[model samples]
Target: MEKQFTLRKNEDFKRVYKKSKHYYNRDFTVLVKNNGVNRPRIGFSISKKVGKAHQRNKLKRRLRSIVYNNYRYINNVDIIIIPKKHTTDFTYDKLKSSLGHVLNKAFKEKKINYVK
Candidate 1:
């Protein structure tokens, strides 16, 4: 993901965590907050409990790829994605579908709006 579309600061993540509405699925918990920007931004929070460093990095990469591919569907929100322990067992397709399901649900509920 581009730097401009990724949340890089601790404060930014904290703000989303504190003020955002949440959406969940078996593999991930997503926090969504209106950013009032022209584009969406995303952050990942993979804990040590999820796995070793390399595993966490791999998960982040996969998620970034998924978000990049689906960027056009997301609106102007700041999102923090927290992967559950079960995610370590997921293949890329599985993870992508799981995240997509939660995002679709969020959009349907109007918790997060979808762009064209």
Candidate 2:
């Protein structure tokens, strides 16, 4: 992903939270919205309620990996993945599954095309 396309500030998160389309699954939340920009972007928020610093970092790593792995093939949407408390103990497979599953559900609900 391009550096400039990333969502990085408190205000950006607030905007997405307020204005974006959101979807949720048992273990993940996927928020997406068209910002009318030409590029796709991403950000992550793993809360302290999920665990201590180590667990939070782990969750971020999981999300970053999943996003990077799939970023190239996705459409130009701004994505923010918020990991809930249940996400802390997730394995790689679980994380991938949760992300993919929830994102697909979200896409379906919004009628967004996701090329496999």
Candidate 3:
């Protein structure tokens, strides 16, 4: 994801966590909030309990690729993704599908139109 499309500030993540509507599946918990911007912004919260530093970094990279690939289909919102502990064993495709499922569920309820 591009720098402008990423949530980098601590306050930004906190705001999304406290105020956004949440969606969950086995692999991920997604928080979504309208940001009143033209494009969407995303952040990932992978805790130390999930894995070691290298593993966490790798997971973030995979997620970033998935989001980047589907950027055009996303609405103008702030999204924070929290990967569950079970994801430590997930393959790239599994991770991608899991996140996609949660995102679709969240956006669908909000009446946001986006191509899958």
Candidate 4:
């Protein structure tokens, strides 16, 4: 994703984690908050338990690509994605499906609308 659509600051992450609710699944944990911006912002977190630096970086790249490609379905929210240890066990398609499912669930629960 572009820098403009990315959640970069520590304070931004803390605010979302502290104030918003999250969706948890076997692959990932998604923390979401309405940012009131025209576009959504996203951040990714991969713990050491998941992998080393190279593996973590690769996972982040994959996630960024997935989110960027599906940006149309994302609304004006701040989404923080924390991958679980077993995330890498899945293929890219599986990961993408899980992420999409989680996001769709959150959007429905929060009554947020996104462009199809």
Candidate 5:
């Protein structure tokens, strides 16, 4: 992901976690907050509990790909995705579908306000 489309500062993540709405599943969790920007920004976190450094990095890549492919469907929010212990076990396709499912559900419930 591009730097402009990511949450880089510690404060940014903290602000999102403070009052952001969230969605959870066995594989991952998503926290979202209205950013008031024209486009959505995203961040990913994978702890050592999930796996070693390399495994975690691989999972991050898969998750980023899911976001990238679905970029148009998302809008104007800052989102953070945290993988669970078993997330690394999922194939890329499964991961993508699961993320999409959660995001769509949030939209349906009006948790994430759409832009355009």
Candidate 6:
């Protein structure tokens, strides 16, 4: 499937991290912000704290798969899924379950009448 969204730049990440509200549930952190578009774009952040470059990239690929699998149902806010320090040992099933629960919760907590 196509990458329906683009990752945010370091500057954009800083701006949103400062201004946007967030939620955390052990597995990931979801940051939501209105991009004034019809559909929201999503991004992921896997820091060096997670592991070495190999481990970090592996987790990044895993998280991207989670988002790609459900791209159609989710869209209109910039979302950044951060893999936690504990996620380095994540199994496929574990990651899937975590992504499903957290992604849904992020949307659930979002304002229903948000402007594009």
> RMSD to native for every prediction?
2.4, 2.2, 1.7, 2.2, 3.1, 4.3
User: What tens-digit string does per-residue lDDT give for candidate 6 at 2-111?
Assistant: 54476557776776677776877888887877666666577778888888999988888887776676766655567777778999898977988877776666677543
The candidate, 1 or 4, that scores higher on lDDT is: 1
Ranking by lDDT: 3, 1, 4, 5, 2, 6
* CA lDDT of each prediction against the hidden true structure: 0.85, 0.78, 0.86, 0.83, 0.81, 0.72
Q: Judged by lDDT relative to the true structure, which candidate is superior, 2 or 3?
A: 3
**What lDDT tens digits, residue by residue, belong to model 1 across residues 1-116?**
78999999999998999999999887889899999999989999999999998899999899889889888676688988899987987899898888888787777866553322
lDDT of 3 by residue, 2-80 (tens): 7999999999998998899989998899999999989899999999999999889988898888888887877679999
**Full-model lDDT, candidate 3:** 0.86
Count of backbone collisions within predicted model 3: 0
In candidate 4, stretches whose alpha carbon ends up further than 4 angstroms from where it belongs are 110-116
Clashing pairs for predicted structure model 1, backbone only:
none
> What stretches of model 3 exceed 4 Å from their correct place?
110-116
lDDT of model number 5? 0.81
Question: Predictions ranked by TM-score, top down?
Answer: 3, 1, 4, 5, 2, 6
Residue pairs that clash (backbone atoms under 3 angstroms), model 3: none
How does each model score on TM-score? 0.91, 0.86, 0.92, 0.90, 0.89, 0.82
Count: clashes, candidate 1:
0
Q: Pick by TM-score: which candidate is best? A: 3
Please write out the lDDT profile of model 2 over residues 1-116, one tens digit for every residue. 45776799888888888898889988888899877777778888777799999888877877787777677656667889887897788898888887888788867855743423
lDDT of 2 at 27: 88
Model 1 vs. true fold: TM: 0.91
* Model 6, global lDDT: 0.72
